[model samples]
Target: MPDYKHFPLADTAEGLTEAEIIDWKVKPGDEVTVNQIVVEVETAKAAVELPIPWAGVVTELLVEPGQTVEVGTPILTVDVDPQGAAAVNGSGSAASAVSAETTETAEAAEADADEMKPLVGYGSKTTVAKRRARKSQATPAAPAPEPVQAVTVVAPRPASEQAAPAGYVPLAKPPVRKLAKELGIDLRTVAGSAEGGVITREDVRRAADGTAETASAAPQPVTAEYDPATRERRVPIRGVRKATANAMVGSAFTAPHVTEFLTIDVTPMMELRQKLKGAPQFSGVKLTPLVIAAKAVCLAARRTPDVNAVWDESSGEIVYKDYVHLGIAAATPRGLVVPKVRDADRKSLAELAGDIGELTAVARDGKTPPEAMLNGTFTITNVGVFGVDTGTPIINPGESAILALGAIRDMPWVVDGELAVRKVMQLSLSFDHRVIDGQQGSQFLADVGELLADPAVAITY
Candidate 1:
């Protein structure tokens, strides 16, 4: 008899209540080692691969792909006892092996009927099984209609004497049925456009609009022909997109935002970046204007620490930190993600450039770990890459302020009492009004602008 162990979905991060199973790496009867990647699950934040903590042979998959399960729910079961498994296999009798396995399962269930075992990192709790009421098991079908007689009476039959169509059942899904009910449309009278005479939501809508043809008409061939009216595609909101939406909503409403803008000549910073590209220390590092802005923000935060602090409403206190965990906002195919560069204040220009390069690459590949996105003190969004001017940016939740960098363009400016063309850029800073006053916000933005105006000032400090 083999000892079966249940693997539950672990709590991967703070405030994560559930995760959707995206894929399974191992199936039943496959041998697995300890710490082996078993399944990939998608939380609201990102897609993470869960490792099996113990070595075993996969016995069963309790959950299916695309199903969203709550934390601490058993996702799979494994047989950990190798000797018992080998004995069952050596028996050579399939029936006997199955019987033995069944007996062992029953015995184990009886022994631990009142107790639940917790998987690593996840708490244990007894879950009540609630099977969904399937449509097949819900209402019985109506009787089939009888065939017409060769000879019929001249007199018409009464309403109660009429028979329904043969094997006729509305094939709409639950949602489609509900929609039809709400639209006051009879599903029985609507024609099904789906294969096998299945009713679809579109069919119901078309029927309601008096545009649906009868099912008895010749069925249309299912082909690749596209129609503009029905050519729309829908993508599910999950993973990074879902997380970004919730956080943005919370941040927008919770924080009292005040945005300030400043336009400055950044010709010196651009020149400095070009010069650094040839330096031996920055030979392979890719330096961009965003990197310079990030360093300037760190330097400015030293003078105004309130901009790097969090306003904790629950604790009724403002949490300030001396170290800066700078977040760089990166847009990926999945959605927008902000992965932080840890201890950014302590890194040099070359080091910061390297870190930014690697972080952005990882984020674009959709491989940013959840931990990399947490605990950001301040965020920088380079919307200038999209060839747009500066616009007010929303602050990330738990962070005090966010800085937006606009596209740098050659514009007219005054230099030594003479009009000249200079590389000018705009900066927008949105801060939490509760923690940072207007004067402090203005001074912080000014400091950042001054650094960009004269890159040599960074060395003086």
Candidate 2:
């Protein structure tokens, strides 16, 4: 009998534990070539195309698209050998023997295709098992997933009192939980007032205020100890999330991040934006402060080319790129992604707006290709969309700086040495100190601020 080997999920370059099958390029019964992309998997970081290492017909698809698979799971099966037709009188002709030999050769080639890489601590070479590896493949004795902690928004009752029957701990976001922990409040002791039995940040604050009652409940012993889950979410980190995570981590630690803030009176720019709204060219396009900020960054890059260069560790030099690949930080359902606009410096205002719109649309739809997410020269993150005033944005890896555009609101400002009301906004620039010094960074930021303060300055730039 010929060996029918199953193709297990391999370790993608990124160390991801599980990946969701976004799409399957090949189907059952399809003859696949070695190293051919057969499936697209989405990790938390990005979506990557998985290539088949063996050449054979796909006998069975073990998992369907949108299904998550753990690393080392057998995703599909391929039959290396097909049965030869029955011979008359139990006798085979000369041509049949030759054809069987050819089939044997093909089967042999298929078997030879998948050469298992050795696992450490094993005394001898062991081939990967034909069956899919369980979630506990690495450590078989691990326990199941832990139960979710319940949140109670009401205050702790007297020593003898107990919680309401339906008062279970509520679910809250990680950041909200962090806040509660910082305030030294137990999540379970507080009664969740948010939707769907979820704990809100406000609920935690209300508990801290000492005015809220603990939903007629006593302080119960913390019985929930989190268990080590054998169940893992293995994502083949290949796409935008993967790229963005790598970039953010690299930029955060390596870059001596020095963020400088400048609050500007943008009353004139707002007037200009309003005037441009009536123009025929600005029709149908979303005219926001982000568009102006993008143009500003482009103008600033022209003034300071060093801001748009990558630090080449291998060459021990900085590689200054002539063209600008402006990365716009977009938050999608999957994760944070920075898709670039190629030659953004050369594009007209309308063209840049159109490209930015299209890039964001594609990224949100999860249709943006892998290559478009790479090789960014600089990044712009608009925190204003989230109603944030300012943030020290991390530089995207390979780039020297990132500009954060803050919320634009009407505020009291000193105009011509007098306190007056104006449309005030802030610009926060985070730069890699290794490449950009305080003076250079300040200049670049000032140039950007100037452009935003006066839109007509872009014509000269």
Candidate 3:
């Protein structure tokens, strides 16, 4: 007889509540090996591929693609017995007996499976169902008043004037008609380019432009159609975007945030970055300002440990970290994700660059594992890449501080009593005021700025 088992959604390190079934790798009756990736699920953090723990033949797919299932929900069922097929094919009477026994066993097994513990952790707590009181039937509402119809009167026109000329109606696709309508262009007045005198998008655009030019010469009152489709769009927030939103809200309201800004001349850091790019040790590694800033953060955190600590409200204590798990905030197609570089304080500059590169690549590919994002001691968000000057960034949940790197631009600076052009950058530091005081936060920000201003300062620190 075949031994049946169910596979439930496991709790990943991110503590995901639900995930959408992005894909199913196996169908019913397909043989799957132990530890084989059987399905891909899109959780709030990333797309995770789940593997089966035991080899078996897939009996049924409990969930379909595009369905969002709660954690601990059964996703699939499988049969572990491979020799049951041979036994059934051997003898007719024996086969019938085994079939009846298997039916009973399967029914009992399914019932037991319902109470089975989930593969990852404890199952959801059982809730007692309470009977709701029946609501009294409502009385029928009074009939609504009839709406008044408006009538219009117009003088009759001659048939020649009322009717349009034959083939005068503009030939155009539905989209073209809609476009013309939106542009307030009368199709009858515009010329068509197609063989059948059908209007194309280009023709409509040209006509609209001409109309704009004509109107520019002499302004006229124009009436435009309101298109709700173009006015607004609604996207369901469920995955990474949803998680980020929740975390940000929680962090903002729960933590007393204090942000400080500093503008620094980072010419030396930029020069060092370019030099590293050409070095053999830094070959194949992306040497960006963020890498230097991240290293600076680690060094600065060592001097001011409060910036790397977390506030424990339940225990009424501050948890200061001795080591650093530096998180680099990367904006992916899905959403913003911060994957940590483990033991960042211990890694060399080149090692940090490589780790940042790998983490960013995995995040961009939407393949970052949930575990890689947890337990971050500090976070750095490079808003500079987007050309942003500076932003008051929110601290990531459980972390005391977050640093935002701004765009590097050429600006005039007074150097040695003379004005000259130099690379300038802005830094914004946001920290939990409860764990990090204004003095400590300011010191940390100044240290980072100093390191960026003069890379040699990092060696002394």
Candidate structures ordered by lDDT, highest first = 1, 3, 2
Off by over 4 Å in 1: 82-231
In candidate 2, how many clashes are counted? 25
Model 1 poorest ten-residue lDDT run: 146-155
Give the number of the best model, judged by TM-score. Answer: 3
Candidate lDDT (C-alpha), each = 0.75, 0.67, 0.75
- For candidate 1, report its TM-score: 0.70
Q: For model 3, how does the per-residue alpha-carbon lDDT over 191-251 read when each residue is reduced to its tens digit?
A: 6666534568888898878842111111111223466978855566777888999999999
Model 2: lDDT equals 0.67
The window of 10 residues in a row where model 3 has the poorest summed lDDT is 146-155
TM-scores for every predicted model: 0.70, 0.60, 0.72
Over the stretch 16-111, how does candidate 1's per-residue lDDT look in tens digits? 777777789999889988778899887877777888766878877766676566666567777667445443333254344433444344224312
User: Comparing candidate 2 with candidate 3, which one achieves the higher TM-score?
Assistant: 3
